[model samples]
Target: MSGSDGSGPAGRDHPFDAAVALKPADTGDGTYTGATHPAYANMVGPYGGITAATLLEAVQCHPERLGVPVSLTVNYAGPVADGEFTVSARPSRTNRSTQHWSLELTQDGRVITTATAVYAARRDTWADTEATMPDVPEPEAVPVTPMPDEVQWAKNYEMRFLDGALPALEGAPESPDSTTMLWVRDAPARPLDFPALASLCDVFYPRVFLRRGQAMPAGTISLTVYFHADEAVLADHGTRPVLARARSNRFGRSYFDQSACLWGTGGELLATTHQLVYFKG
Candidate 1:
């Protein structure tokens, strides 16, 4: 689904995907607006940024740079209820090492949020280091997990809960801190390039970390993922697992920070992430 209003005045599909609308004029003033859905807001992260990135990559000197997302910064300027949403973007600057894109997501005449992203310019340097993969559980061997809540975004990837998953929805442990692990693979049915892989990798924030108590819900407002390497730990599409470990840093009313590790089955550190979030009940 894209972003647009709930009304099905014309062509429509997923209600939450409606709010987002795109201006193709490249008026140097390109824009995308989307509708919002209550269910999609909590379920999906920010599709506008994602769609914008995908659009930005189209014109980039680089051919379809959709692999890993090195960093993503999002500002939640206002409430974004589900309906139809739109995103717009253009090249902010260009260079060899990295490319920058300025993007915005809006609904109707109003702006829902804004985003910025950075992508690697050359062949990945991280993969140069040689290391053994982790010896985690066989991804398929582990029990399959059903998606959570009516969260539509969760369906974007294939997830296998290693531990601390089923109980997460009820709120975290009674203590102050905790950790959870999951084996995740994205777009499993379809082959994904490096950039899209990184984007999806960073997409699951907020709920990525394990926490204690119900006093407040601290989730990521911004996240950065550094891909150390691109070695495939899992060759079979049937099942593949990447270890996702979550831990919190400082906690506050307005914001907090946390870190996560995404590892290969061979226990190799594939990617590292740090997130800043809005924390409050």
Candidate 2:
């Protein structure tokens, strides 16, 4: 409801709803507009995860939504200024079981983000999981690290860090390993769904900050997520915390690559994500 012009659904009853609330306006054929809320705002723009979810929301709101998400890729072209923004989603292809969509988000008439998603009607198939869940203490065993006041997005979720944190900027030694293991879930126990799961995939802090232990200028340029579980898995998960692990493989001149794995409480691989981030030293 932050940017609603009395045209869209007034559903800010939950934080996840508030994060992806889109005000549908009759802009034209296949084009829509929505407002960004400060509740999910980041340093320079709204959180990339919420923006990604909003793009998916556009497709879900469309009358021709295909199925649940199988994979999604979002590219942050420019900063999404706080205020009204436009999102457009179009079906590129629809097959027997899978559908493909392309979307773009703009503010002030300039494209700030672009995304592509693939959704499909799943069925029983041969399944095998090779990734093992990290052996760690239970979510309740780990202490929740209070989010700093400056980060609005961090406050929306409860992050229990098992290892890796912002190193003291003063004279802190660089960590030999850049991996982090944590348990994450909505702060107020929101139900796990496709949209919420998409947002949670990006809840981890940028790998650079976690490794260097100092907040440098960094942001995700491209993010991609592959969903391994179906709707039933998420519904069964309820409000349980997800076990997540993230690590960086390479950091080059101006970009770095990081990969993360998300697992359900019963050791099911829910999703795997990778991102190329832009950073300034």
Candidate 3:
């Protein structure tokens, strides 16, 4: 939603916030309605990140939401047509400390996306991060990576690449592996939040682009994000850039797997995400 409600960075109009704005539906079935934002549109549909964030927002705004999201898994069932869509988030189960939710997005009468989320009331506990942020130059030290203008969603994020940038669209040397490390944040600098963090989990380009050094048909089939930071951590993070690292495990005949991690400025593990991708050469 627009930061006008005090949910975003002050005095700045951010398209990312607009892209994720959702309103409760009048159907009285605990559903929400939202329209696609042109600024976040992808080559074929809305950016997968925006869609994921929108789904998470659906849960975050639910009246019965128990707590902050700890885990979210969204499955892309089909292409989302450009237009208005409805989302339904229903609590499937609730425990003393955790809650499970089932979510769906529909356009017209067809299901475009499906998801599951887990929210929990966290308690102070001992925690440590085994995965550390890679040693990279400061965000200011690295120059901005120019994004393809055709990809509308890419314009919403400021990205500075340290390694494994997208290869030439045509012939290019293949890389030994698909590992990308970069610093990214909202283009206009928005405060860190659950929806923003969810969207950041998907900022990486398709692994195939880095591996093959050429663009190919690729799309995420399903994505899962594990939140490690809480509201306090995000509030402390504010509008600073975050370090993001991602790599692919296997590229089979038609599918591949991507694993990624987002680290705060102080090397705190913000979130970990994994996704299955479909590709065609």
Q: For each candidate, what TM-score against the reference?
A: 0.65, 0.93, 0.95
Model 2: per-residue Cα lDDT over 245-281, one tens digit each: 8899999899999899999888899999999999997
Q: Which 10-residue window in model 2 sums to the lowest lDDT?
A: 3-12
Give the better candidate number (2 or 3) by TM-score: 3
Q: Candidate 1: how many backbone clashes?
A: 61
Residue 216, model 1, lDDT = 37
Ranking by TM-score: 3, 2, 1
lDDT for predicted candidate 1 compared with the true structure: 0.51
- Tell me the tens digit of each residue's lDDT in model 1 across 1-281: 43475555323333222322333443445543334433334433544334433333333323334443455555556555556655666657666667676766667758766667766544634444343444557877777675664655556556777655534556556544445567776533433333344444444445424454333344445555565644343233123456676666676567767677776665666667676777665
Local accuracy by lDDT, each model: 0.51, 0.85, 0.90
Off by over 4 Å in 2: 1-12
- For model 3 the TM-score comes to 0.95
For lDDT, candidate 1 versus 3, the one ahead is 3
Candidate RMSDs in Å, in order, are 7.0, 3.5, 2.2
- Candidate 3: the clashing residue pairs are none
Model number with the top lDDT: 3
Question: Tens-digit lDDT track for model 3 on 125-156?
Answer: 89788998888888999999878888889998
Q: Report the error of model 1 at residue 212, Å.
A: 2.5
